[model samples]
Target: MSAANSPDFPMFVSVAEARQMLAALLPALETEWVGVGQGYGRTLAQPLAALVSHPSATESALDGIACRAADTLGASASAPAHLQLTGESRAGVPFAGEVGPGQCIRIYTGAPMPAGADAIAPVEQLIDDGPDAVLVQRPASPADVRPEGGDFRAGEEVMPAGLRLTAPRLALAAALGHARLPVRRRLRVALLSTGDEVIEPGQPLLPGQVYDSNRIGLSAMLEECGCEVLPLGHAADSPGALQAAIDSIGGADLLLTSGGVSMGKYDFMRDLLIVQGRVSFWKVRMRPGGPALLGGWNGLPVFGLPGNPVSSLVVFHVIVRPALTGQPVQTLRLRAGTAFRGLPDKVAFWRANIVGGEVHDYGKQGSGVLRSLSEAGALVVVPEGGSVAAGDEVDVVLL
Candidate 1:
């Protein structure tokens, strides 16, 4: 058989082509330093380091008397020796004078320890505490005191660039005295749906018509990827309508459309691209979403997806998402519990559910079956000319 007639035909492009296509399309936007509390899901633009030494200075970790550990080593509860209290120290305050021998400073938690003090004797372990002197109830150790820079060092790198500032990470940055964080600009994506037979959800569906779902679904997924979605709404199934919608989204970095790309009579998306932009490729050797479209419009990337709900979703995840995020495509292999009688020349993606570690294939694996796509946890990827027995291993692409 010729290459085209082979059961496992390959349509491959160089990895460099894929990477360059992504880079040429997704140019990084200007960075902004947003408040740390509002920086969730944003990629960090610069590394964050501690502004000052943690603890800032020597401090006490407990409400106690600051004293030299050696002086209190032999003092016991039963027969305690007295030490004069020079003064009291609270949080954010430092003892004004140094502690001398036979003298201690009253210190609270987080207070800077007075000079000449090596440890803290907790309040419960002290007796007859007055401003002048106090008696020891139990001996204390050096471990009771928290020294300067105990938790973190000065000028230490806390979080590096490219970090997605989550809630806890923001709090940590705030604790390190970072009021604002530099983060990558959000990606702007334009969403459009095309079809005369499709109507918006909640609108009355006439005979031979269905609700338009791709726009809502794709917008949600794009937002989850941190993209600022500019929804251009639905475009009618006509060359003029498609061109008008494309023109309206001229400012977007990426343009994503559902439907009107297949080799059908009313496939205006391809014709619109031929007229307005460079059409790189019209189709891929994949099932469900084989009739995919990749092109550029006014120097921006445009992906024309199949109108069928499952096909649109599959192509979006497997091809479009990775292309937009500049990430590598991942694949997996597993057992195909569903029987395949014969293998075809094209790779197929079947809706499947994993039950008890076994893949159970769903019936009616049609491109328009949005219900099946919603129910499926993964797509069983059957390579060209591949077949599977009940317990045989198969490749799967997790949705």
Candidate 2:
């Protein structure tokens, strides 16, 4: 018998236990180089350092005259400091001449300060004195100058490995002189939804058949977790069909199946895994997703998620995501907007949204209610035997 079927093994494990168990079995994703512009949503494979310092020299942060801070000391609107406007500077065009005593340069945002200039006098705070002079009405300090290496310096590490490259991060890399980035390859998963009653949308539905909502929801969520989903569509509840689907998982890092994990006669995944595959764990001790399993077959990890759309999503968030990606689902603490209770001996994830600094649970936390998952921005966690009342603080996982 497989380990999951062993009497000494716990058929149902705690959420933390499930994660820890799976962690040891997962492999580190490989990495590759991709253009920086196409790196969005990809995880970095190595720490990246800036190649060159930004603003290589002292520059202006605003449209203003670059001046010696000492020149404007004690000056105000009533008694302004007057200086000769020797030259002008704009982005990528610097004034080549030096600013001597009683001299300043007209500069726009991001222009390097001319030699000997130590501050900026904003255009709004300066009086244009004809074509060759400016009057600064306020005191200026070195603080007004955007110093060299202010944003980042050469050789400074700006990004660490395993960080997902979002738009801002990609922009940062691009600004730091990176034309391409080394990012982890997206994990490819073969997804199959089992059940004779399940059909894809736009198909004619029979009396008992339903649209395959689980596949749609899980596919999108998997992509959000940075996995490339190879959707195999729905499979009939038969061993022959199931085995065929499993055989087609070639080249995929994982096989993700929805349904067929429960104990009913038609449920074949858990037993089939025990008989032909190595089952690490079969069930998680959590509400809405207790019927979940993780194991390996054909040298690829298999994650059997519950068929109910919400339960499938919850399982993915609570266990599969971090286990597969090595990235934690982000979490935050929010106050409960209304009272709620947890499962007697299991952890429960209630669909919720943050509003006015409080958690508003979407109505009905049922496994079948896909709408709850759709409308929620977060999931409020309640431990076993725990009860939350108005204003009660609880940890929630962001969706």
Candidate 3:
């Protein structure tokens, strides 16, 4: 169906409409119990709370002497305060006796502050006098010490559901005494690239044939989004071959294919799905990826991206990826380094490198120029009928 004629056939849709269709079609996956060690990059299935209070007991935050705050109230360089050293307290070893009015304990970082002591005078502010005495030239207050549960309290929520865990997040979970975490089950994606002229990489290419890169590129992007990819390899342009490939996607959560979605005699993907009236949208009203396709197959969601390398990647970034991650597209307004003329009929996304708030476009904007996309860090978005001049603020989508 042509975009101009398919009014009731659901031909071309705006970017926002495409996203809304994906949101309505896909939902969050099920949950699973995974060890914290294996939780990195996985989304949280449930809210994660602290299992126990961090630093459950009062502990010294630095290498210091633990003493009563009152004893150092008037301490100064000229009128230094002197206290008797009753004992020493190192991490994992507590002092045997309580600190009296004139007594202090030699303590190291992470050591428990002795009983009756309310301050930690760092060693930098103390002068050790023999084995039993120390002189303090400055006062240390309770502010210098870490109290019980200073980091996190038991049962306090530290991570909310749907959050992708990173290294820092995993560290936080570990500090909260978590051995395992509740995270979403890994998403399985069936990947395929269809074209009779497409050959596998590393194989000698014949005339009129190019190597298949969409499968590898899309699979890498999917893995980065925490998906387990089931590579269905390449499919020929014939209907029998495509049907075999489709049937091979046995248990995957979603089907993602590139090529053969446009309006051409050999564009079998669109025609096959259009016959069943399963295709929701056959085109996107966006540059570089106008031929993108979204549809359903045997109750599974399918995303058919354009054949061009850059178009496939861009459509994935703007459509399939966000749906898989359950994350909204984040747009930033940045200063443009050059003028950008918008397309009168479609939304345009130009490959550009953004550095320190300045957006510089890559020289070429061709959907076939994959090298241009490789050099870009973001996509400078130009709305239909909108133009942006140099130094003007424009919307940017980070790649």
Candidate 4:
């Protein structure tokens, strides 16, 4: 028997242990090629290499006079070295002639370097001695020249596989002359929020009714994780309703259901998964998100999330996100701006606002408090039995 079911261990598991189980059971997603312009937010399936060297040849980095460094050796305002200007080079146009002794060529930014020239005398430092000749106020150095293939070389690896594409990555791919990028196809996730009290946002609210916020909120989160969301609507706290809803999830890669996973009498999803689903209920040792279960239903992976607004999103961020996106949870150490209570038995992930490198709690750290998660903008991590005094260092994960 698993430790989660052991009489000594009770009904919960450590976050570390749960993640191990999840990693071993999760399936790899499929991949496809997409236009480089449309590759934002997608994970790369293969490594990308630069097709051609940037600045394929030696070019000018500024609009200046290109002359041999030896020719500008004693050139200054009082005793300026004069050189004959052979021709002007700008962008695609290049001065085909070589810059001989006592001669210079006009070069613009990104223009190829003329033959026999190694230094650049910027226009601002030149005496403008007419179109045929110019006076140098200062000596030019070779540092002013932009060497060939300066930014990157051809055949060099630009990006490795499994990297999530961003705006900058897309720009790099386009600059590298790539037309398409091989990326993982967005996973199709089916979501259902369960509870008789939950109703759609537009509907009129009764005395005990709550708006159906999880369905829409979770969908947006899944999209940010690069998944394709399939909204299955909401279900009541009934076996038949949830069963029919699960049966209707056709072609979805994963299943997510909020509510009905706790130990309450109306927790039909917990009882249904125990009876029919391949995976059983397993709580995590964390406040607000301690009520979470994972397993498979009809060969489909299922994540049963808590109903409370903050709790539901916390579970998604700490667990379901990594399973779907293949990204590990990353946190940083920040000083606590104020005192935060500690849980003796479970780890506390407090919704706290970060200011000037310190973490501060955003109102009460309750499961049902949605504003805390919104206003805080980050989750401060306090380990089991570890309380934070003011200015104490704590781990935090920005949302």
Between candidates 1 and 2, which one is better according to TM-score? 2
Quick one: how many clashes does candidate 1 have?
Answer: 1
- In the order shown, the candidates' Cα RMSDs to the true structure are 6.7, 2.0, 2.5, 3.0
lDDT (tens digit, per residue) of candidate 2 on 1-399 = 433346644578998888887777766778899999889788999999999998688888888888888899999999999999888998888899998989998899888988999988888899888999988899865777888999999999988998888889999999889999999888888999999889879989989887998888788878877888898887899878888889877688888899988767787776677778767888898987998988888778888998877888899888988876788767898889987688788888888888998998777888888888768888999898887888899989988
Model 3 residue 325 distance off true place after TM-score fit, in angstroms: 1.1
Query: How many residue pairs of model 3 clash at the backbone?
Result: 0
Q: Which candidate is the best by TM-score?
A: 2
Candidate 1 Cα outliers beyond 4 Å, as residue runs: 1-23, 50-158, 168-172, 329-349, 354-364, 380-398
Candidate structures ordered by lDDT, highest first: 3, 2, 4, 1
lDDT of each: 0.77, 0.85, 0.87, 0.85
lDDT per residue for candidate 3 within 1-399, as digits (tens), equals 543355554666898888888767765688899899999889988888898987877999988899999999989988889999999898889897999998899999888888999998999889988889999998877887888888889999988988889899999888888899989888888999999999999999999898898888999999988998999999999877887888777878878899989878898877767665378887888998999988888788888999999999999998788888888888998999988888887899999888777998787998889888778899999998888899999999987
Give the lowest summed-lDDT range of ten residues in model 1. Answer: 1-10
lDDT string for model 1 (1-399, tens) is: 122232232233232343355446677777987888888777788898888777878888899899887778778888786888888889866889998888898899999888888888999889875658899776766887787777677699988886666778887788788888888888899999999998988987789998888888999989766788998999898888888888877568888889988777788886777666766666676777877766788887887788988889887777776766555556677777777433366667788888777777887788888999888888877667776678888777777
Candidate 2: stretches off by over 4 Å: 1-9
lDDT of 3: 0.87
Question: Which rank order by TM-score, best down to worst?
Answer: 2, 3, 4, 1
